[model samples]
Every structure is written in structure tokens, then in C-alpha cells.
Target chain A: MKILFPIILYLVVSLLLLAPCALCQDEVSGCVNCHSELDDGDIEAPTELFKNDIHNQAALGCVGCHGGDPTSDDEDLAMSEATGFIGVPDPTDIPKICSKCHSDPVFMKSFDPGLAIDQYAKYMTSIHGIRNSAGDTKVAQCASCHRAHDIRKANDPKSSTYAFNLPGTCAACHANNVYMAGYDIATDQHTDYERSVHGIALLEKRDIGAPACNDCHGNHGAVPPEVGSIDKVCGLCHANNMTNFDQSTHNEYFDALEMPACETCHSNHYVDSPSTDILDGETSVCAQCHNSDESPEGLEAADGMRKSIDSLNTSLTVVKEKLDESDRKGLFVTNALFTWQEARQKEFAAKTAVHTFDLGKVTGVTAEGLELASQADVAADDLLAGYVFRRAGLAVSVFFLGLLALLLWLKARQIDARQQSL
Target chain B: MIDRRSFLDWLLGGTVFAGLAAILYPAARYLEPQEIPEAAISSLKVGTIEDFPLDSGTIFKFGRKPGLLIHDADGKFRAFHATCTHLSCVVQYRKDMGAIYCACHNGRFDINGKNISGPPPRPLEEFDVHLKGNEVYVSLRG
Candidate 1:
């Protein structure tokens, strides 16, 4: 009874677990499943290959496509010689398998169909598809980046080909320098990208738009660009700026000197906020190229502007100290009222120093120094008023105490006089 | 008759007394050690127990601070300040190693808020938690 009972339980569990997939496998059970019995057809395209495919893992079986009595285990009943069981799909019909979901507008809407269109069209043009069309079957397909069963949103950090992870995905193939070297391909793109501004910004700041290797090179049908066409790639966004840069004397000078082009100032990867000081005088980026002695005027202007800024900063420190002192002495109301006035003056002074070369702005700048002095006078007046209020309270309290003491002394004298009279 | 001289003396004495009182009041305030106010505690909600998974550390946001909610394998739930006391970077839960790690300076904290490694001078701040029905509550004071 124990042995029989164990066998009965095992059968019940197995039947329950396998029921769903077993039902699915009855119909459209492909040629590969029955291939051993059949005398017709090549055997190389193994059913084992489809085990890793998305449909198989999802438990959708061969009956979904080939169509027949999936319930019937008998070969003759399941495989009708005429109309029952169909064979494997042709290479041409591979698109139909993909299009089942891809062609459905509603199903593909969540993924943004425009992206799929571009991806599919680009893939067809890619070397993989071209070779596959010519009957070379080992190239990558749609399921490569978007995994078979584990497909997910691009924004998900865990997604295999997410923006942050794309480099690592491409590096799987491209970073193998030796393997790719045979194909005349260099994998140094990853190393160079890591050092570029785009790479640093993407890694450090997590900027999504910062271009990686796939942004510049095609993910599927990538090719190297001509040396003359380098500027065109850069000119996509920096067209007007590059045009002016091309006309500038620096471009030709760099060409002659064998120095770096516009990228020397702007940088190629991970470009940052440009320093305004760079434009103010020849001391910044220009100094990198031109000798400091050659441009005396530019160098002098930069130094003068710096000194003015420093002087204004020093003045601001003095004004802040006095205001703070006033607040500490219970002159809060007065300081609060006009302190911003003095503070604004200091701010304007700083602005003037920063833009000293602009004479028109500096003329209006002296008003801040005068305004600061006037506001300090107002705060001093407010402090004097508070002192008077404090003094008044003290005077009244002291007067009352003194008057009471004098009254007590007089009453004591009266008492002594009365006692003497008695 | 109250003479001008006497009146002036009285006024001067009153001013001195008032000035002294004004100075002393603020001085007393400065001398007193600030007691943590009860009003500050009332506003803090460490979050309910259901919000935290019993087997993992869930991050809870309280005011400007982040708190960690950890559920042990034995089904016990605990919450600690996510801030590293050393430099204030948010500490992360390392599920595999069963420890909390600070990325900025590598400060490490054990499950009980004890500073286990790196330069942290103190343990993480722990809040008292209670479960009522399905909801969990955290208090500012343990």
C-alpha cells in the first residue's frame, strides 16, 4: 500500500505540472518532434534550438503554428498524410513569426512603433540580415538586444541594453580586440569613449543624451567614417559655432602648428560649462596657444579685471562685519530694514568688477558704494532709538524705588519724634 | 519739589538697571542647554510596517532625512537612519553580505545601527517601531 500510494501521488503531481504545456504541444507539433520517424527532410535545424526561443519558454508549443490534433499521441492520428500536420516554417516565413506581435499596432504601441520601424529597417540593412538573406544563418537577430523571455522597458536600469549598460553590451563583442582584430576592427573605441567628455558625463552625472559608441556608430551595420568627414559629425549641433570657428584665425593657426582643432577648447567628450574668463582676456584658452608676451594688452586687461573683483570683495567683507555687529547689539529692526540695501550695493560692486571692461556698467556701479554708506547711517539711527527705549524703562524703575526709600525714611523720623513727645 | 539733579540721577540709574536686565535675559538663554522640543517629534512619521518588506531593507523618507527599514529572516522589522554619521551620504543595504554600506567614504553599519567599519564616529539613529494590525508605526524616540 505504501509503494502503491507513493506511485499514485507522483503521477498526480506530474500530470498537474505538465498539463498546460502538454495540451499546447498536441496541435502544430512540428516536424522536429516527429523527425526521427519521418524519412523526409534535413535534420540539422534541431528542435533543441527553439527551446531557447521566446515562444517555447512561454510554453506555447508547436501546435500554435503547424496545427493538428495535439491531444493524440498516435503518429497516424496526429499526422494526417494530407491536411493535418504541417512542417517547419521556411526562412521567408521567419518574418511572419516576428510580425505576429510587431505588426500588431495595438500590441506594439506601448513600445513606440516608430522605434520598432526604424530598428527593423536598420536591421534589414545591417550585415547580419544581409548575410541571413543570402542564407548565412548565424548572425544576430531582434532577440539579441531585447532578450527572448526577459524583455523589459529601456528605462529600467536592469534592462540588458539600457543606455548606461549599452557600452558593456557592445563591449562583449568589440572589447575582444584580438578576435575583432582578424576582421580589421579595433576595440579602442570603448577606451577612447571612457576618456571623452560624453563618457565622463554619462558615467558621473548619468546624462542619458551623452553619446556612447552606438550613438555615433551603427549598432548593427557600423562602418568607419572618412577623416575629412570628422567635422560633419561635430557640426550636427555646432554648425553656426563651428562656422565661426572655421573662419577664426585659430583654426588655420592650429592647422599650421599641428595643434588640436576646436575640440581643444570645447573638448570632444563630456563638454562642460565654458568659462566666461576664457572670452574676457587672452589669458584663458588663447593663452594656451599664443605666448603671454605676444598679447600684452589682453593679458593686462585680464589682470586688471581680477584685481578690481578682489577689491570689491574686500569692501563687501567690511560692510558685512558692521551690519553683523549692529544686529548683535539689539539693532535687529534697523538692520533688517536697510541691510539689504547695503548688501545689494556690494553685489553690484562685484558685478562691476567682473565686467570692468564694460565702462557703461561701471559708471552706474559707484552708486552701490554710496548706497551702502547711506544705509549704514539709517541703521545707526535705528540703534540710537532702541537705546533711548531701553534707557526710559530703567529711569522709571529707579525713580519709583528712590521715592519709596525717601518716604520710608521720613516715616521713621515721624515715629521717633512721636515717641519722644510721648 | 523734585530738583532736576535728583530726577537726572534717577533716570540714569533706571537706564543701567534696564540695560543689565536686557543683557542678562539673552545671556541666560545662551547658557541653557537646548532641550529637544516635543513639537519636533510629533511631525515625524517613520512610516507603517506594511510599507516595509519583512525580508529586505526598505528606504523610508522622513523630512529631509532617509530612514532604512530592515526585516530580518526571522520576521523582525527594524528601521535606522540611512544617513552615514561621518559625512551624511545615504547608506545602501547590501543584501548579499547582510550589511549596510556608505558609498561616499565606505562607512559600514551593522543591522543594529552600530558603526562596524570606516570612519563613522557613531552608530545610525534608530527609531522605535510598533505594529498594529497590518500597519507599522515608528516613533522619534525609542
Candidate 2:
């Protein structure tokens, strides 16, 4: 009784201790074990790659996405339709699958409390989402931008949705003309975006703050901005210019004409650095809509604003030239540099103020700028004049000192002669 | 006493002093820090309560930048940085709109300085409005 009772007690205690661990074993799934032993690369790749997946790290297994029996060792049982095994879900069903867990605040919060749960809700509003709902299989889904098995956090550099990689990820579907054949939209957006000011800043300069494909056109709720809201989209970063434009006379006129406020002047997707030539030169954007015959007032305003900007620019150039000259000559021009910086700031304000379309308002800012530039020019002039004065004084001192030395030399010669006679 | 040697020594000494002064005078001026103005505007007495009527807002200069002060419909005073978060344009209070408006992008902020609409990515920076004997003063928030 003693030997049998001790053995039974030992077995019962061992089972009691290890039963919870067995029940709680998330990694005990049959899917990966069998999938890893597959002869086919296509069937086996996911098992190997998913070992390092973010979902795996979070303790989610194939059953979480594919939905099958995880504990069963029989291949037929694990892959059986009766167990709800859905192998290779359709693209249209991808959002539903992802949002099942992602859309639930309580479920998402358990993993990441701060993670946004609105993506699925916002995705429904997007063109892609609307198309996907209509049974269009080619449109982007959750797995398109974020890969199926190798998903990582958006902030991860290796993530497909990382700011730097997002462009290429979007381009994968968007850049293919054949893939986008039925759509009315152009496929040139990706290539055009690559050469744009925003793209250069983000792609080449690696400035994450620079807007990517998702900034203007939202990521989940992507849409082309309306004509009226184009300025608002651009103004998200170009706040000062938007401020001037929103209050300008052209705001109502453009709204009535259905002309995009910013895209009319700054081309969408391929915006280049705006030069003053766009205002007064042969390639004037204002001249496109305005003429000396019909829209005389607009052309006049453009001319006046252009001339005001030009005047300040010319004065600034002159002042800068003078400052540079002083610096080159090794003159102390700190005060002048400070004055130049203030003047340059005013010039920038004036340029932004041009959106006001008020000639007087632009000239008012430019007038202040011109005055500051004149002051800087005067300072630079003084620096140059002081240099000249110092040089002249030096010449005069050298001449006088040379004359004194000659006199001293002659006196010494006379003294030597007198000493020899003695 | 009036020898050439002494005269030469005096000349050399004057030349050396002039050279040293030329070098050291500018250096001293360069090294000497400019007297700093109030390093930052932590606090300012913007105006009296009477200056801003009920349900009124105004932009007041706070040092180099501008600040917006509002007297809400509830008769409470609120102050915030007037600059728009998107493009740094000075925001204005539209009486008809009853919200702080950035004319640049139609960005709107509530009386509480929260960004409500348009393109601004951040809310307006709020300040503490202190009332002392009918005088309204704006101070940086703790």
C-alpha cells in the first residue's frame, strides 16, 4: 500500500503541475510542423518565414488567420473544411479577416493599447475599399501594402509600410499600367512623384517628415482631393501660403471657376521649385487665364506683384553682393549679416504674401523688405568704406614714416661725416 | 637722455602696442556676449478684461511672435499661440464663424484651442489667462 500509494501520488502531482502548460501551449500547432516538412517551396516558405513574423512574436499562429484545428496532428483534420480551414483566402476577404481582430478596440488594445483601431473603419471609405466591396479583386487590401506573413510595425525600417518603403509598396500595384488598365487614373503618378520636391526630400534626403504617398492622399482613406480642398491639402504644410490664398480675391474667383487654388500654379504630383519667372516671364501662369484684353485687372495685379517682388529681389541681390564683397575682403560684417537675415525674412514674407493677390498688401510687405535691404546695403557700404579708409590711412602712415626714416638716415649720414672730420 | 636708441625703442613700443590693439580689440568685442533681452516671454499683461468683450478674440504681440486671446461666450478668458500649426501664419478669430480661423488653409480651432478642422496637424498652444483686478494677463502654461 505504501509503494503503490507513493507512485500514484507522484503521478497525480506531476499531471497536476504540467497540465496547464500543455493546455496553454500556443506553439503546439500542427500546421507549422507539417508545412515545414513540405517538399514544395511555395507551401514551405511561409512556415520558415512566419517563424520571425510579428504575428508569431505576438503568439498568434496560422489558426488565428487561416482558422483551422491547431491541436490535431492528422493532416486531413487540420486542413479539413469542417474545422474551418480557409487556405488562400480571396483578396476581397482580406480586409474582413484583418479587421476581425484589428477593428475590435478591446482586442487591439490587448496587444497595443495605443494602436489606432480606425484603420478598418477608414478603409471602408477609400476607393480601394469601395471597389473591394464591389467584388473588384485587383484593388489593394491590407495584405497588399503590408505583406501577409512578414508583417512588421509601420515604424520598423524593414516594414513594407515604412515611410521610405511605402512609396515602392504603393508603386507595386499602382505603377503597373497593365494592372491599372481599366482605371481612368494615370500610372505616371509613381514616376512623377519620384521626381517631385516632396519625393526628393523623402526618398533622397530621407526626411520622414516630408509627405509621402499617404500624406496628401490619405493611407487608409485615400482619395483625390476636391478642387476646393486642394489648397487645404497643400496647406497642411504650406500654411503661410494657404493663409494668404484663402483670404485673397482669387479664392472666390477660383471657386466659381472650379480651378484648384494651388494646383493651378503649382502642378500636382510634379511640383517644381517656384521661380519668379512664373509670374512675369513668357511662361506666366497668370497669363493663361488672364489677358490684357479681357482680364486686365488680374494681369495688372500680377505685374504689380511681380514688379514688387522683383524690386525687393533686386535690392536684396545688391545688398547680398555688397555683404559678400565685404566678407571676401575680411571685413567685420556681423551687423550687416543680421540686417540681411531680417531683410531676407521680409522677402520670404512678401513672396508668401503674393497669394493675397492684393498688390498693395504685397508692396506693403515688400516695402518694409526693401527698406531693410537698403539699411543692410548701407551697412555693407559702411563696412567697405571703412576698409577703404583704413587702407588710405595706412598708405598715408607708411608715406609719412618713410619720409621720417629718410630724414633720420640723412641726419645719421651728416653725423657720420662730422665724426670723421673730428 | 635724447638718444636715437631711446627714440627707436619708443617707436618700436608704439608699433607693437598698435598691432596688439588692432588684433585684441576686435577679439575682445567678439568674445564679449551681447546683453540678452528677457530670454523668453514667460508672462505678459496682455490687456484688461474690458478690452476684450464677451465672446471676443484678438491677436496681441508677445515679443517677436503673436498670441491670441479670447473671451468665450461663457465669460471665461482663454489665450493661445495665434500661429497656425501647419504653416506658421497668424490665426484670426472670426466672429461669424465663432472659431479661431487660419485664413491660409481654413484651419479652425475651438475657443479651447483644439484643432477642429482643416489641415493643421496640431492644436493651438494654450496659455493661462490670469485676471487681476479687471486686468487680464497671459502667462505660459505650467
Candidate 3:
């Protein structure tokens, strides 16, 4: 009996020593069991919330985050401070809590090879992080946007930081006048964005190609786009427009006057679709800055550009209508249509050249368009004239054929009368 | 003496012959292809060295097809058929990209006539360039 007792006691002690390590490898842990069975709402809420968390899906238990004896059923042993049990981290410490695994390159690679580990580093440079580090608890923490227990990948549609959802996530704080009052920032950015062309494209049309909040401000290191860099931010999508603007004479002028390039006329948050109306007239963008009394040459150039574009557009429309008429009359109008297409391309080129802010360049392209339009018009007119000539020739040929038939009949009658007289 | 029946038979035969000749003459003329005068020179003179700016390309007519003449940044003249090998869309020299680009399908080719990107399945057809006394001439490759 004594020998058996000693062997059994040694086995029990060894199993007890190795129990926590084994539980860590298992799918379930004692921490979840205790917390789930607790009647207190505070303790039970975390267990329920943790069930849907990404960590939970990865088989990470409460012990993975809180640090405790996950193998122990005893409350005293499970919550013991010696086992590194940190019940709840402070708001300021939440970023560090998330960054523990996120910042470790080796650890993060095991989860996602392509996922960047620079979020924590970038977050440090953000206004929120700077303020949070300064002991301001009101500012956004990692949990505020990502949600503490149920964090998801940014690409996930349900994620708060998804491209389509980011604007709303940011507006939650930014749009609230009370929240922004302390920061002395405009709270109507969201309202203004909802009405802008980009916002309508994203929110109303549901176009994934459209820009959202983070597309310009950046997500991790969010900041208002600087005046000097705003053109580049917009250029990410409007490459051709940006290229044209960069090469324009206004580039140097805007830089010298410390004016934002695109926003000077287009506005910042409420950029509308461009129209030719912005090129001339009393309400023209140029007239807003340059009046005939002050800048006669600039006004004349603007007027000339507007008139040239208008003339090309009018000529193109007239030629297209004529071609369509000829086509409807069963005439071969393919050649005329091809010429019209060339004119249309020239007109588009002329519009693009307007960004050059050079009247000669605009007029040069418009001249080509006008010439093409005239050629197409002449081609259609020729086809219609050919149709008229064909009808007249057919009528003349029918009259001559009738006359020939009558003459043959008369000759036959003469021969028959001669035979009768014989 | 010529009888009336014999005279009538001769007149009917002549009328049929005239009608047949009138129809056949027009038909023959319509079927015949119109002759266009061909230029005697196999090679086309594009321009002088002063006419073509350095590091730029100019499109000129080579018989029926469009030819591209490029004066590369190194001051060497190179010529290629402007039509893309994929869909025969004319390619333009993009100074920004430093490559020949077809706006049709976004096909691109290097200055050396190498197909680089997009839908172009073959390099641009290169032409032989002849330089004489500051004048540039281009001919189809043998």
C-alpha cells in the first residue's frame, strides 16, 4: 500500500504541473466556462462578445488577452495576479494591447503574411494617438473604430474601416458639433461630402471606384490633406487632369500665391462636375478672378476659348443631324459618319486643351474639328444630291424607253399596212 | 433589186447589234478597275534633319500605310510602321512614357520596336532609314 501511494502521489503532482500548458493548446478554456456561468452582467457580456471576436475564431481564449490560469476551475487560482491577470486595460493602453500581436512581425506573419505591422507605428503619428498619449481619454482609440472584441479585417464589408464604411465611421465623431467643438474643426464636412460629386458616386451610386474619407485623409495616419499635397491626393484618380494642370501656366502662379491648385475653383469638399459654363460669362471662374477692367487680355482669351468650343460643338451637332437624315433616306452615310467621329474626337481634344489655359492651343484644335465637321456636312449633302440625280436619271430613262417602244409599234403598223395594200 | 423583207431583216439585225453593244460597253467599263498612277520611288523622303525635332516622332505617309519617323534622344533616326500589330490601330509616340503607345487597347512598344505591354502580340514592323545630306528617307524592310 505504501509503495502504491507514493507512485500515485507523484503522478498527480506531475499532471497538476502540466495541466495549464495542455489547456492552452485545447479549443476551450476554464476562463470562458467561469465567465459564461457567471450571473453578473459585466462578466457574462465579455464572454458573449468574445464568442464572435476574430481572436475567438482563431481559438484564442480569454487567457490569451487577460492572462490567467485558464486550466484552473477555481476562481482564486484563475484570477490570481501572480499568473499575470490584467482584468481590463485602460483606454490609453488599448492600442498597446492590440499592438502586442499586431506589432510583432514574426507573430503577425503566422496569421497574415501580407498584413502590414506598421499600423501601430502609423497610429502613433495620428492626432488621435498624440492626444491619447497626452492623457485625453475622449479622443479615438483603436477600440473606438475597430471595436475591441469583434474586430474584423479592413476589407470586410461589416468592418467599420471598410472603404465604403470609413466615411460613416469618421463622421460618427466628426459630424457631431458637440464632439468637434473642442477641436475647433468643421463638423459639416460629412454633410458637404454627401452632396459632392465624389460622395454621390460612392454613397448613392455605390461605386467602389469612388473616393471615400480614408482615400484622401489616410486611415491609420489620418490627417487633413495639406494644401501643397492636395493636388497629388486628387491626382491619384484624375491623372490626366492633374497632368494637364501640372503643365499649365497656373501651376507656377498658384504655387507663388500659396493657392490650392484644384480647390481654387473646384472647391474642397463640394467639387462639382465640370461644365463649359465655368470657362466664360459673368459667372465664369476666370471672371471671378480676372475682370475685363482689370485683365482685358485674360477675359478676351476666356471668351475666345468659350466661343471656339461652342462653335465646334454646334457644327458637330449640325453635321451629325445631316448625316442621320441621309442615313434615314437609305443613302450610304458610313463615310460621312466616320468623318463626324473624327470631328467629335477633335472636339474632345479641344476640351482637354482648355486645361492648358492657352487660347491658341484651344482654337487650334477647334479649327481642326470645325474643318472636319464641314467636310462631313459636305459629304452628306453630296450623297443627298447624288440621290436626287439618280431619281432624275431614272425618270429620263423611262421616258426614252416609252418613246422607243412607240416608234417600234408605229414602224410595225407601217409594214402591216403595206402588206394590206399589196 | 433588194426586196422589202430582205431590207427589214437587215434593219432588225443592225438594231439588235446596236442594243447589245450599248449594254456590253457600259458593263465592261464598270467592271474594269480604275488605274491610279504609282510613285516611281520605292523609298519615301520624309523630311530634312532640321524639319524633325530631336527626341520626337512624326507620322508620314508610306504609300498607303502610315509610317512613324522618330529622332531618338541620341540623335539617331529610326522608322517603323505606325499601325499596331494587334488590331492595326495607329500608335503614337508618347514623349512622357518614352515609348510608342496605341490608344486603342493601351498597347505599348519601346523605341527599339519591341512589344512591351497591353494587347500587342508582335513588335512594330521596323523600316530601313536612309540619311543623306541632312535629309531622311524611309523604306519598307526587305
Q: Per-prediction RMSD in angstroms?
A: 18.5, 8.3, 11.3
lDDT of model 1 at position A284 = 61
Indicate whether candidate 2 or candidate 3 has the larger DockQ: 2
Q: B64-107, model 3: which lDDT tens digit per residue? A: 45778999899999999988876566778988999998764467
**How much DockQ does model 1 earn?**
0.02
Q: Residues B56-101, candidate 1, lDDT per residue (tens digit)?
A: 8877654435677788767887778787786565676777758887
What range of 10 consecutive residues in model 3 chain B has the weakest lDDT sum?
B33-42
How well is each residue in A1-422 modelled by candidate 2, as lDDT tens digits? 98899999999999999875554354434677778888999988898778667887777778877877878877788879998989998999999999999999999888888889999889999999999999999999999999988899998999999989999999998999999999988888879888987788779978665678888899999888889899988888678798889987789989999999999987888887656677883358898788888778887888888898888999989989998998799776666766676676677777888888888998999999889999989999998998898787667556655655665675677678879999
State model 2's lDDT: 0.82
**lDDT at residue A51 of model 2 (Cα atoms):** 68
Candidate 1 per-residue lDDT over residues A1-422, each given as its tens digit: 98899999999999999986676554325444665345543443335455554456555665545545555667676756454465554444444455666667786675465545345455567765675567644345555565543455566687666778877666666777665665555677667677666677566667654556555556655433333443445544334344544665545666676655545555543355433455445546546654567766545554554455444445555555655665566454333334444344444444423323343343345446546655655565566665676677557656655655565565567678869999
Q: How good is the docking of model 1, by CAPRI class?
A: incorrect
Segments of candidate 3 deviating more than 4 angstroms: A1-89, A313-349, A371-422, B1-142
Note the residue pairs that clash in candidate 3: none
Write down the C-alpha DockQ for each prediction: 0.02, 0.10, 0.06
